[model samples]
Target chain A: MTQPPVIEVNGLMRSYGGGRTLLGREKPVIHAINDVSFQIAEGETLGLVGESGSGKSTTGRAVLHLERPDAGSVRFRGTELSTLGQQGLKPYRKHMQMIFQDPYSALNPRMKVGRFVGEPLVVHGVDSGSSLQDRVAELFKLVGLDPSFMSRYPHEFSGGQRQRINIARAIALQPGFIVADEPITALDVSIQAQIVNLFQDLQDQLGLAYLFIAHDLSMVRYLCQWVAVMLRGRIVEMAPTEQIFADPRHPYTRSLLAAIPVPDPDRVRPDRPPFDVAANVPPREAPLIEVAPDHFVLDHQVQ
Target chain B: MALLEIKNLTVEFDTPGGVVHAVNDLNYSVEAGETLGVVGESGSGKSVHILALLGLLPCPPGRIVSGEAWFDGRNLMALSDRDLRSIRGGEIGMVFQDPMSSLNPVLTVGRQLKEVLTRHTNLTGRALKARMVELLDIVGIPHPEARLSQYPHEFSGGMRQRVMIAIGMACNPRLLIADEATTALDVTVQAQILDLVRQLKHDFGTTVIWITHDMGVVAELADTIQVMYGGRIMERGPVRPVFHDPRSAYTWGLLNSLPDEGARTQRRLYQIPGSPPDMSNPPPGDPFAPRNPFATERCHREVPPLRDVGNMPGHKVAAWYDLPALLAAQSEKEQTP
Candidate 1:
């Protein structure tokens, strides 16, 4: 029996700068995400892999309703979040959260870490007073940080420690689903492994569903069970991690995977085509076709 | 004869807490026209050592406690300010991580490129303009003539970095130091830059000092790899031997920490349990001992001398364990399936 998805996103579209210029001329429209669709099963991770300007972050934010998409449908646990007002969305917001790429900027530096983490609880009115303190301390321990560090400022902690605090804040209200956007990209490799492991451990313990957005292919492969390849504001391919890695059908997905700098010195990287968007643009827009059981690829037919 | 040799290089910073030993009694030599890749986490002194060699570090808080950097039959440490200034951009060029900030935002790209040429060469007027355009062309910039008139803000990240490379190659320096040059760029762009540098190294016959934390980048670019940690070189050898048969446990940890290039599995990544050591109060023995899984009694109490591996020329490792034993243990771990 297939379990229902905790988060469902369909036909998501977002564009930037199209209305008018200072001279009242029509401005150029940059499609950040176009007709994107995906689902995150309960306690599952859906990896979104793409290069910069590929609309991965926009998709994550759009699903959270943080950046209201121009057109889309976002359903959280059978409830349509797109049509809900702020007051109505408040109840569902407690279950969904977001963890940013840069922990330094994501958190408020002036406030104490405890206050920052417990802010979610205060906003949601989940707990207060001594019980709030206990939850904050428990969160610290869960993310492998000392409880006493809650009183310290964000500057006192290292990058990894700050990220742990960020994770503590993200999971403070017992969020069932999180959009971790490039959570480990800014970290060193050694520290990166620690964060990835922590994410896995948290997923297993809390039964959390994650929309893991990142540019690192190997990292995505290591952490995610299902992967989606995004390019030019659309998902070109989506499949189980093993199958996608074993045999990627889309040309864009193949290029992206091959572009990754493998640690092996013997690996011969293909000659990279220059960053010309016009050159790689699909000659004909292809519909998402099922190549195998639950596997889809955008078969862009080039003229 | 070695192109550059450094001996007993020790750098320290006097802070409110204490003196932070950044580089301690390091000895290494680089051959002419070879790319020396330095891999280390932050505070490892890889960047600091080069900065010190280049006389780029500020002196009130920072001081080169002791060391001799021998290059071109002269001690770079003893060079006067004026003398060093002549050598810096003329004899050695540097490419920093953030190219946008490195290149002046207000200045036109042409003027910036010409300034580097004027400082080191006698070319002026039309000759200088021609050389600037040629340098831009060599670095793979499109419409070199038009790009010259544009400011740094007009160019993209990759384009700005190319402009920086053009400036670095303007003087045709013998040694090029690139510190985290490609770290900020995306993988595809990084591959392009790596390829450009690799090709430039051959074409220009310039020795390179490539410093970064990514082992994959080092493997792709550098002919030799130097694994550094806690102000010391943990391992140094040709890329193949150092990767295939790493004697240092730290190197092993770094290699294992890298996600396997193949398919994803249920296996947990190898994590080095602790952070890097504090420079102010560094350990008495192996700096990596606290995090090393195979650390022994000697690793904690006594420092291991840099010794040549048995019958492996040019491969030196600083560790307490014997080569055969370490390889046996590594192979055994690999056999676990």
Candidate 2:
């Protein structure tokens, strides 16, 4: 536990569209992410879960520096990245990569599979010529894909296979950390297991840290050791996966857990209050209080 | 008589890849007021079967190869387009996956509801206006009168879906077909819509056909479940027995792959080994045999027929393996140190 964190984010904040409108009136600003802070240790998976518009995706992007935040600092391997210029941040880009939810739109359609996977290495000036082909083949094999299909286009592959390609691209640079945003949501049940397992295997083999952002609790629990529940751009609860599932403190977290339809017909879920009731309540000014060992809950008094 | 009955229904789509055998020899029935949940992944032919029943499949590329769809003592397949039109919106209601695309964007919510009311009923003038407001209120939309004047774009995603539900249930149809109606909404909003559907079913005794890929949603809402894979019904039975004691290996795989929130087991998920078969040219034998770990020689040679599982009434599975032998083998495997 004494090892330094792989990525550290402190008091991160981001907003969208506060400028004047075409009618010369001021437009309303949407605080997409507010005062978010988290740490991902080396070779660990940290899950950020929330529904649409909860800013979970924004938090993932902000940490990876894909979308710059308006305030706060992102420290990667003890190096502050928030103030780095574009050229200064270039070297750090290879240490982190992102995978998106939709595989169809993520990859360029016109490019061949080998070219797409090798593009990262080419850009980084790490491998070239015959070595690039070898590296692409190696990546394809690592992700459980057939290396012979390098010449095929993305259209020829199914949804799950396309996701594997996305994973291969994310790891092509051998980054120490990766941010996966809803990586398996678009896949089928059988294929989801394949991708999720591949992620675990890759993480162990490469000693990679992951920031897994998703909306499904079951998948998050399966893949992550620690989970942070976000609501309306704020972290309401942060705990180990077991504690979050077994003993959720926040009312919003409890309702979110209850809303998950368990796949057992004999056990019907007891009705709970609508989640918005808790979301509509104002946030407490108090800081996150540790209720149990390493389990933090937002100190908001519920009505 | 059952509200709707289908036997040996088959549909094919002439795609560039070849003729896709979408629905093959599908047989199922829904009672007057019961809810039937159809579960399947994409390209499993669940949606196509419903579209075929409603006569919505385009003719050139899509053809009802052969089948008899009996609804209210009438063979729906034999009915003319003119007859099917009335049956579609009058006796049968449908809600689709995307609420935004289903509703007319430019039309005020009231006009759309009034059009359906006018087409299927004798109400007119103030009576029509009053009925429209009542329909909106029944679906749990706030400020019903104000919502009626607003366009579809003015409402949120959940509200638009509620409007779609109101339009579908406007005539109090005997059967309601909802195809992934809540897949687009957030979990909280999905729960609300689900609760609303359950209430409507109780109040009006409306038969519901809810099709989705999520087994959790099916478990929460359906009284009976029909699992479809590769254009065929793998298993169909009462929800409780199907979950407790599955007869089909495919169903077992589907259940095992699902990550349960209740118990966090320290084991790898039981994944179905391969992808779903290409439907354009389906294999000669059972479509699931390639991926099924428990597949037998018979499964690779011939298609399994739906038969009753042991003494459980109304439970059927299209599998060659006996349930007792599979269960015994499974327990033996588990017991091994």
Candidate 3:
């Protein structure tokens, strides 16, 4: 709490399909992310969880500057990111990286896995020649993949292995922060554990901060120190991992928790009614209110 | 009598690499009004066996090497294409994982529903339209009549899945097979879909074969659980017994791999050591033996027969070594430390 946070985002807003048409007809604007604000400290993971179209991925993209936000500020180590142009933001890009959901499409089909992993190092001008090869090999070992398989194409590896390749590339620059959007979603249940363990290991070893955006709440509880619940382009609740799981204050957060299918057969699934989004529309202007120590819930009432 | 029965079912693919053993010597039966959950990762043959039974698999590359699937006193394997077509959507309805791909993009939701009804039932004109509306309502789609004219792309992912379910339930089929039906949808939407399925089961007493890799989903919905690995059933039993006392190493590993919801401390997940078996050239012995920690020499040498557990009724496991004893000793060692 003493040192400044690694990444601090404030009032981040991004919308699509707005503005007047050529015919002067008004077009409806869809706010993908609105007034999203959070901070991730050094080596801490902030889990952004919600259903599809809730803008968790949009928030992550905006934070990483992959998608330029319309308004607000992204401060990486107290440096303003939203105002920076493409060329100006290049230096900050190395400190932040993103891993996408689908590993198959994220990788190049023709490119060797080694070259793909080392591409970041080459782009950043961190290393070259024999040293680059040695670094890529070290990265492969870090992610629990055999360095020998670096020569093989992506098609030769499985879903879990492909994800490790993506992770290796993401951490190749030794970035201070990473935005892993559903990294374990595509892999099998068994493979999911391995990848999760790798993420934890990498975080511990390198002291990397992560913006883990995913729908799997259980995995979020296991990995993240902080959790943010998103709904309709706004974070409805933000709290510590234990607090979010143990005592969710927001109605939307409680509903999300109730919806999770428990792996235990003996536990009877609660027959709670689905959260009515139409009935309880999250107020656009309402700010987050502190409910408990480090726990914030959106100031909105259920209809 | 069982609603559906399969014996010595084996499926293979004639790939360029080699003959891939997709499903091997599978034998099981689904009782009436019971939900059978088939759990497995990709390429485990959980979906393939169903495709093979329904005669949906493409010939040449994919072939049913040997199998007999009995349904309603007739062997599904012996049925002609015409006969199988009549029974597929009529007696046994199917809902696949991807709703977008399964549904026709060009046709309106109404048209697709009509197509299924026309093929299976004799309801015509107003009656058919009424039936379609009723189907949509049953699946919890709001304002079914207004929504029917909308195209597939017009509906949300969750709504489109409901439409898929409505189509599957159109003919009032005796058995419903949902293969990872809610896998693509978000958890909130998936919960709604699961609720809809649960409602349908309560109303019609429909026998369901729900195939998914999510043990959590299966635990919530299914009466019986069948764990598949490398195209073979590693374990099968009532959901409660199987989950609480998994006899197969693969099943045990899968259960342990999930993050324990009640764990006070965040501990490392118990990962199933190796990747899934390569079907192109699967090991002659137990398919999961290589990855299994407690695997013995016998397990690596020869395949174990699916045998009934000593005390648990209807519970069966395919394994060479005694898993319960091994787990007991392993736990005791950890506890002492």
Candidate 4:
């Protein structure tokens, strides 16, 4: 007997166009995600993190075919997603869904919350009538939304509430894996915890796997068991959470961890790394590098 | 004496939803050469308290109801607008979150930097231009001479922040109010900005009041921590005890809920339940009582004042329970397989 991994991305690649250099030749292509590979066992959350150009978001989108990959393959539940035809992939979308960071743009302003969530099921021909409404209420209840507020528009809810609606819609089809992209960054600090806890509760109850993409190291550390650090479209480091923090072998990882301002004054390092521009030279290239066990460093490598 | 001492601060705002209490009876002080980190979730009033220092918040919707913002022995709160303006940069500088928005899109970086120097230092013409280049270079903006003519958008997010820091230091003010200064930057750049702020504080002996919701920042830069909730001080003390053995349940939940590398074993974030109280209708008891696990009848019926836990050296926490024991319990819970 065998159980399939929830989601698997192997050797995925993508790029953006580059501006011309001073020498009047085309600049090196931007590697959004290059040869990235990872897996999330069923019900596990794998965190993706990095700076602005790190390509973690691109990888998530590429895995879902929201953004096409330049090369490589993505498999979900042993079915080759990259090889699936456009028509073939539509049905599989029921098993995978994505949640975006911006709650304001993610929801349909014109449609009410009930209709918005039920749209997917209606299109998929899953349910209609009282059963659909019941399912919508169930979905709302499942995501901790008040069923009474089903008819309300997205504007009636706060940022946190809107994100809950987004989650309800994502899970409407009972997807096994979800890519939650920065779902709480725009939320209030106090409200962020509620949403995070809700995500946690949902994962436990449904056995859902999450590719939690975010930049907050502290938050990611809490939600994800295995984390993959990306920089310029390359997976710089991938590891179990404890080892990465306890012994961050990569210099970038060390610097990232060290920079977390410890709130404890007594714990404040008496000596701090000097802030010198000499450190952080605009990468003469890209993809810092693989240095140790499940850790990668991006010092300088273009694509 | 402390360089800045704020006592009895009570700022109010006449929002459409009635008089909103923003900062309520805030009392804290920063030494001449020390950093104070004012931490809280949004609407906890830390930002208002800091902004009230400079009289920056608009008067129509916001008003300082009562307070003594004594900086170097002068009452900044009661000072006239003109008087406050005179001291805003001449004695104290302010930097805010969102460098993208805080910076003027049309203005050149050099112009903004030089304006501060000219306003405070009585410099002009070539002397001022030279000073601007010098200031840019000092802030680690490479090739300051060539870069001076470039507009704000031309620079990267991190570089723009450095420029803002240079402008803040232009007057060499005794204090800098960095309200979420590095929240917009990435981790690498955030470190750089934090390091830069610390270095500037060290080099110039400038007192810093960093107002942010980020716990990591409170951990990294604060010598002292003040946790705010419901427009009042929930706890105030040195940073170590606040993180290690916080008495306030709100503070405890905040620390636990924050994700970090060490917490991979925990499948989910230990987020504090419920929403922050509506300020207009703040509960009579502990603001965090609704969400707090250890809250009791007293916690629900009456507010817990900032009671001195007085356990660790120089540590102070405000809570009804034996928080030290709670912290031990938390540690044990986290340690379990």
Candidate 5:
């Protein structure tokens, strides 16, 4: 990326109230995301990978200010976002957008696809007349959808096509940075490749920096230049793509790498070693410790 | 002898739009204790084929266009609903993609297992309780005696999938149709589930129709792979040939697109250029012709039948061109991204 970092996150910390009542209700504080930090260079792709409850999705949402952080600061370009309240954040939202994982659930079923995609444009007072329709049509083409099909509902399209529409909506604003939360995870096997390629295309054409959150480790290695492996609300490892795959030192990272199915039938990978089942895992109770030049690991506690 | 044989099975669905030819004269088989992985993207009719065999398709919408699914020398397509019901869940269990929706939320996990057991066997009282605990243990659920009382939501994503396996194996079904069962799981959880399925096959001689989109996962689990496209089996053969050097252009595109564990030299991630052929108005030729980079005029004009590639026993491919060359080209194209 020729430009400077588009987004910088520092010492991010957030936890839900378990014992205390948020709305007079009891819930496991989830410890959703804690003390996470990362940066997205201009047009760079930073992937966050983990199993369920890893808090990757939470971290992405928090940076967009969709959720309040207990502690931390988020900076976009040269401006800081942590100081922005609802009123102050409204103007800056035009520069940022989010693409959710589930297209069907994320979209408003009751509304027309055009209205849903164009709603952001309208809210920002960007455009609303014939120009809005033109922009929407252009977006449809950009995302590999037929512009004539804009007069449709979310339910009308299949999983893959619906995802294309979701992509169109996310890129509608020409935002500087985007948070795509598992955008292609719900798609079909064949559809995943198309969606992934579309992301690459959009990134090149629009120069959009993205915080890509997903569970698919292989695609992450392909798509992102840098990656952060999250677990139980903290990043356990971070490094350049090649560095991480060549030698994953963290136990959690190794387990994640092992999870990816080897495509070659002739290949033999000794994935399941005799782990002393009771061996001590790194205690992630504290902050992440640097293990290598770029790689980092958290001492995560295991059962 | 093969445990299950699908002889030229074809299927059609009556949706509001029109009749969609879901499975076109598909023929395949599975032997006892063998796992046949069916690979395809969405709309490839992987689920529909399994649904037809299970007699679980929606009425008026789903009609077997022709052909039959034979198991143990009996034609399942000709069986009465009552007999089919006896086979389903009792003799052949199913596991779907999303574990969250597959299990009943209102009912405890034990109750669900008991339903299948009561349906298949005559076990009751102590025997039923004992069998339930044993099944739970086999699926690797911790503290089975205590978890029997817990509901689906109480378990994590991975644990819930284990419960699904326990339920699938409840009646000790001869065949298990795992339809995208682990697609929703994390890599670690996915590995655990795959290992469990493998163990199930080893212990029970359970033949499996493992439907998934992940090529990597299929390569790991399947003894043989059946690659489907546009509601048809474009390629069916041993996993090695189909995967090592794919014949079909669609299969090539899929393989090239995967994010592998190898060093990150994947440039553009070879993406299939066009969307899957519109099934609503599907054309006459190869369904993947439009999206295939190496597609020629002949590809758009004639639907290539699944042809035996050489006389190499069970190996087969369905392309009009050299598959290995096409795959190599696609692989090189992927490196450019």
Candidate 6:
């Protein structure tokens, strides 16, 4: 608990489609992510959950500096990432990597799986010749993929295997942090468990922190240590995984949790009135009020 | 007689790689007004069988080798293209997975609704316009009259799905087949669509064949559950029975593999060891035998017939080994440790 956090985000803001047009006509601004803040300690996972257009993915992208935030600071190991230009941020890119949702499209069809996995290492100029191949093979083995099949194209591998290839590529440089945006969402149910297990295994072995962004709350509850609930580009609730599931305070959080369809047939799901987002819009400057130890909820009452 | 009965249905696809046995001897029946949920991973032939029945599967590659799909005393498989077209949107409606691709981008929502109504019914002009608006209203779309003129791209993802559902319900079809209908939507939006479908069933007594990979969704919406794997029915029974006590190892493994509320306590989820079966060259005996931990010697050599479970009525499974007994023993071993 006392260890320095791996990544810390503060008052992060990012918007799209704003500003005056050529004719001086005003363009409506859409805040993809607004005033988002969170921290991920060493080897700890922070589950970011929300419905579509809630900016969960944008927050992840902003944290990794893949999409630069319009405002606020992203400190990766106490180094501010927002201020650093592309050339300056090159060194830090290896320490923080991202795994996207679609396994099919994330991988290049033309490239061999071995070269794809080893691409990061090659870019970073870490290893060469037989060593790079050996590293890629080791990475593949770590993700529970057969090292011999590295020569095959992306089409030859299954969905689960393709994801493992992506993971192998992401972790080829042994990054301290990973932003896995809906990593398991695209795979089959049986394969999802395998990938989750792999994520856990990798984290344990390498002591990697993760910003696991997904809509599947059950998986989030199982894998993540902390959970953050986002609604309309703002985090309405932030708490420990157990607290977020068991004692959600925000109406949006409660509605989000209640919406998850339980696997059991006998259990009667309570009829919860849907949270009307249009009616109750969380203000832009709403402060995150601490309700419990390490648990925070946005103060919706403060107009 | 059941409302719709499928017997010995086998579907194949001819490809350069090999002949893909998409659906292997699939046999099942759906009673009138009952919700039958078809659960399976991709390439399990859950969608293909329905497509074949509707005569939607493309020729040259997809071939329905053998089967008889009897719907309302008529063999749907043997029906002519003209007859099938009349039955498709008239007597039997279908809601596909992707609303965006399924809907026409250029046409207004009202036009799309009118197209279905006009093809199936004798409604004209004002009556057709009124029916379109009513259908949209039934699907819980706000400002139906104003919304009708809007295009597919103009609507949100959830609203677009609602429009698709409205189109499916336009003909007042006795049977509705929704293939992974809510899989693409957000959870809250999915919940709303599920409620809308349930409401439709309640009001009109519509029989539904809900196809999806999510067991949770099946548990919530379906009265009966049919678990499919490797293009074969692994298990079928009432929702409670199949979920609580599955006879097939594949079904058991699938239910256990999900990271449900119970799974939260455990350090790791119970993974069903290997990948899904390759349909092109499936194993000789049981397709799921490779991943099934409790597969017997007989399972590796001969395909098990889908037979009724001894104790449970209406419950059927295709497996050689006694799954319940094996699971009991496995649990007992873990308990002792």
Best-matching candidate per DockQ: 3
Clashing pairs in 5: A282-A299, A282-A300, A283-A299, A284-A299, A284-A300, B267-B337, B268-B337
Clashes of 4: 16
TM-score of each: 0.93, 0.96, 0.98, 0.87, 0.91, 0.97
User: What's the TM for model 1?
Assistant: 0.93
Q: After superposing candidate 3, which stretches have Cα over 4 Å from the reference?
A: A1-3, A20-26, B334-337
- Residues B239-336, model 4: lDDT tens digits: 87788777788888788776544545665567677776777667777777888888878988886766667666556655677766876887899999
Model 3 per-residue lDDT tens digits across residues A209-299 = 9999998888998999899999999999999899888888888888889899998889988866568775776778999989889888998
Please state every model's RMSD to the true fold in angstroms. 2.7, 2.0, 1.5, 4.3, 3.5, 1.6
Mark the 10 consecutive residues where model 1 chain B has the least summed lDDT: B263-272
**What fraction of the native alpha-carbon contacts across the interface, defined at 8 angstroms, is recovered by model 2?**
0.61
Fnat value of model 3: 0.72
Tens digits of per-residue lDDT, candidate 3, B1-337, equal 6999998999999998999999998999999999999999987999999999999988889999999999989999999999999998889999998999999899999999999999999999899999999999988888999999999999989999999999999999999999999999888888988888888899999999999999999999999999998889999999988999899999999998888885336557778887878899898899999998999999998999999984779999999889999989998999996
lDDT of 5 by residue, A1-303 (tens): 356999999888888766757677766665778788888899899999987777888898899999988888899987999998799999889889899988889888888898888888998899999999999988988988888887888887878888888778788778989999998888776678788888999999999998999888878888898889887777878888888888786777777787678788987855653222225333435766677786766655321
What interface RMSD does every candidate have?
1.3, 1.4, 1.1, 2.4, 1.8, 1.4
Q: Write the per-residue lDDT of candidate 4 for residues A115-170, one digit (tens) a residue.
A: 99888999899999999999999999998888998999887777888999999999
Q: lDDT value for candidate 2? A: 0.88
Model number 2 iRMSD: 1.4
Candidate 1 per-residue lDDT, tens place, A1-303, comes to 066899999889999988898889999998888889889998899999977788999999999988888998999988999898888988988899999989899889899998998999998889999999999999999999999998999988878888999999899888889999999988866788889989989999998999999888888999888999888898889999988988888777776776677777777766664445446654334677889898888777311
Best by lDDT: 3
What is each candidate's fraction of native interface contacts (fnat)? 0.52, 0.61, 0.72, 0.76, 0.78, 0.66
Name model 2 segments beyond 4 Å from true.
Answer: A1-3, A277-286, B330-337
Clashing pairs in 3: none
For model 6, the DockQ equals 0.71
lDDT of 1 by residue, B3-69 (tens): 7889999999999989999998999998989999999987789989998988998996999999999
Ranking under DockQ, best-scoring first? Answer: 3, 6, 2, 5, 1, 4
